[model samples]
Target chain A: MISFQHVTKIYPRNTIAVDDVCFDVEEKEFVSVVGKSGAGKTTLLKLLLAEEKPTQGEIFFQGKSINEIKPGNLPEFRREIGAVFQDYKLLPSKTTHENVAYALEVIGASDQEIARDVPKVLEIVGLTEKANNFPEELSGGEKQRAAIARALIHRPEVILADEPTGNLDPYHSLGIIRLLLKIQEMGTTLILATHNREIINSLGKRVVTLEDGRVIRDERRGRFIL
Target chain B: MFTSLKRVIRSGWQGFFRDGGLSIATVFILLLTITLATSLFLFHGLSHLLISSVEEKADISLYFKEEALENDIFEFREELARISEVKEVKYISQEKALADFTEKHKDNPVLMASLAEVGRNPFLASLNIIASEPGQYQAITDFLETSDFTALIEKVDYYQRRSVIERIFSLTSTINRSFIFLSIILSLVAILVTFNTIRLAIYNSREEIKIQRLVGAGSWFIRGPFLVQGVLAGILAALICLLTFSLIIWSLSPRVETFFTDLDISQFFVTNLWQIILIQFVTGILLGVISSFLATRRYLKI
Candidate 1:
């Protein structure tokens, strides 16, 4: 459902982050983007989120070109996709429950819907017992779970995990991968970008590899090969 | 719309309580600004009263010669009353003047002995002329000097009081102009400080703002809470300032009355209490709401 049509992103200082990269993922597919550091993985996700505009190419979501979406209509486009980052990006002042409910609240969800769905999503991420704990009070794994809960709370059409386990321990990292798999079972498209060899090898899904700002490999049931 | 409003209010309350330190700082600044505003209002009232009291005390006294008939003096009074600059004229006869002096010094032995030694009215029978303005006093004096009855006039007291009256008039005008200028300067500074404080407060929430945008919250949904917080701070600060000013005026009223007997501070407050409160509330709310609105404009666009 997500497609990048030869997108190239160049920063203002003439530094190219993503160059002429083209790819697509069908609906309800779990796709992993594997690359070494600074291989345009993060840039790809940023372009899809419309956080940074492509310097020379267009991006498409479903059948519509996202590069042409008006600035005012951008929020509507973002609501359809959920994103989790390595930082967890939880509002430090908010409790785990608040962090998850915030996503629903932003979408103007009804109070009843929020009260019901938030707890359910928190339970799915195994954070139900720590709902009242702030980010500083939680462990790294718990923080990532909270972030995952926030991403899945809105039942977005696609979930983009940008180094979701970059800061977690191996055990916690495995837990996050399992959580992503569980979410994919619920029919949500999942795009994971990471340099983790174990994750890429275990996924048994489509893998796109990038090098020097360009896509160098696209393989089915791909193994981790840098 | 109601649902959105409810959410906005809830979010505002959450943000206010969540960022306790920043929220407290914002409210404190608002309180200080409102206090300054209220004090300026009170000072304006007191200054007006002082200036008017001085104006009331400034007047010209026309003394008639020993041979001038009472009827002639009364005719001069009528003619002087016709002058456009004259606000009022009171004619005091020699008999009445004598009686007034004796009544004023009945208990003072020295003054009583002196009055008895003179055996006749030592005071002049005169008409006291008050001009509508200090600048007009000189015009009245000139008119009196050139009148047909100037030969019968003993003296005009306008010259003796002219410099003092003019000084008081200039002082009052200077005070008024300076007060206005100072108020403008202080208000501008207060607004700038308030805007910066609110901007910093919003900057702390930049990440949450980005997240909120990603979740498809409309710009108004995110902005409504900060605006509400500003308005709340303004209202609370205004109420506190009103109470503080009322107490201050109450406590200082008796002492201030000693210097300005005609003005009743408590009475002024009581009469204009509603109007003062309205002004304070409007200023507080406008400052708070506008600052919040402007500070968050750039951040909310994302």
Candidate 2:
């Protein structure tokens, strides 16, 4: 479970990235954040990931203020959540399998476990055939799947995906959405942020819409209304 | 922890080898730094030898007046030996000088005839003074100039040797000082160049680093591979430098020996083989590791 209490993020030169945002999601819920460019969707995820601080408010994961977590314990805390990027930030030097295994390796996973879990997760993302290929050798859709595999290999409680399908074709985009649905159905909380109306409307799940740095609407089974 | 360490090392090797262009550039720069370091060490040895040789060739011989007594010359030798700057002073009597001259020119009949025409020992009894250091030679000369036996002396020979001795002293000191200064400047440049290159390589991997952090990798876990890359580059450079220097010294020693009597570079290399390697290895590895550690630090914030 994650909660944001009146979080406000203002960049330098008086640019409000996220303004007075308050939200909460219970365990195992799938929610989409709909917003235009510069509407603070990515900033929201970054704040939760502790990559950036909220300019003015607190973010809580479970019962603890995520902001108050010491830098030394940050990585330990981050292990409870997974994230995917629009660009599918895969390690260029690593093969697809290695990239996925890296997540487990960070947590001191045994070689046997990595060898076991990585392939299974890669299979779910439909990248089993391209496991040995490097990111450079994979296509756009395949690369995103590899990123998804990396995110899924450890099975963290919450998966924060920031425009995961932004780079994919319509066919591949739908495939990624369906993959997220599968992940959500398996009892993992999913927070997806995207600008695509089709994907948001198709989700028919809880939606939080943002306009000019503030959440304008929130509804159960919400439609894309930005 | 053991499994994690193994994974870290494996990924590090993979990262190093997979970035062909950056790895090559990093290795080349590291090689250059190690080579400069090794050369500085060798030059220090050579300078020590040359300076000592120059100090050895320097001495002042005092030619006593032809009429001065043997006892007087012997007493003067005693006084010269008492000076702290003087290592030793030998009294070469006129008889010994004549005998040495004849023995040295025995192969030349003309020189023997000229010496025989004199019908007696024609050489002067002189005191040969050796100093412990080139700088000390000036003090020795000064002592001789103010000596009470100056009236009994024909020429102190201090003025005669002063120009050459001072030149050698200045030249050797210049070499030592310049080599040290050059080493300092060049080492700084080498370190900076290597650091910046590794920084660039890290910058290229910034995205992957973020992804790693997002996937719950600790700072050390993400840092391990880059540090490993640096170690590999360092080790390879040191080995290459060792081989290169060995080959160069072995081949160039014979030629270098022609100019510097009794100084064999290859022989010196062989004598201090382990020492040289240790210096090279420590320098190369430390530079590589420290640079990587620092360069990767900026990106490990997550």
TM value for model 2 = 0.95
- Cα lDDT tens digits, model 1, B1-302, are 78789978987888788888888888888888887777788789867977888788889898889899988898899999999999999999888888898888899999999888988778888999988876798899889878998988998787777678888889999999999999999988888888888888888888877777766777888789999989888888788889888888899889989977888999888888988898788888888899888877887766
CA deviation > 4 Å runs, candidate 2: B145-148
The DockQ of predicted model 2 stands at 0.79
Q: Write the per-residue lDDT of candidate 1 for residues A26-135, one digit (tens) a residue.
A: 99999999899999999899899888899988899999998899888988888899999998888887789888988887777898999989888888888889999989
Q: List the residue pairs that clash in candidate 1.
A: none
lDDT string for model 2 (B1-302, tens) is 78878878888898888888898888898898889888888989987977787688788889999989888888888888898888889888888998899889999999999988988788998998988766887788778779889888998787886888788888988888898889899989988988898788889888878878877888889899888988998998899999999899988999999998868889889988999999988988898889889988888886
Here, model 2's chain A TM-score works out at 0.99
Estimate the overall C-alpha local distance difference test score of candidate 1. 0.88
Give the native contact fraction of candidate 1. Answer: 0.56
Classified by CAPRI criteria, candidate 1 counts as medium
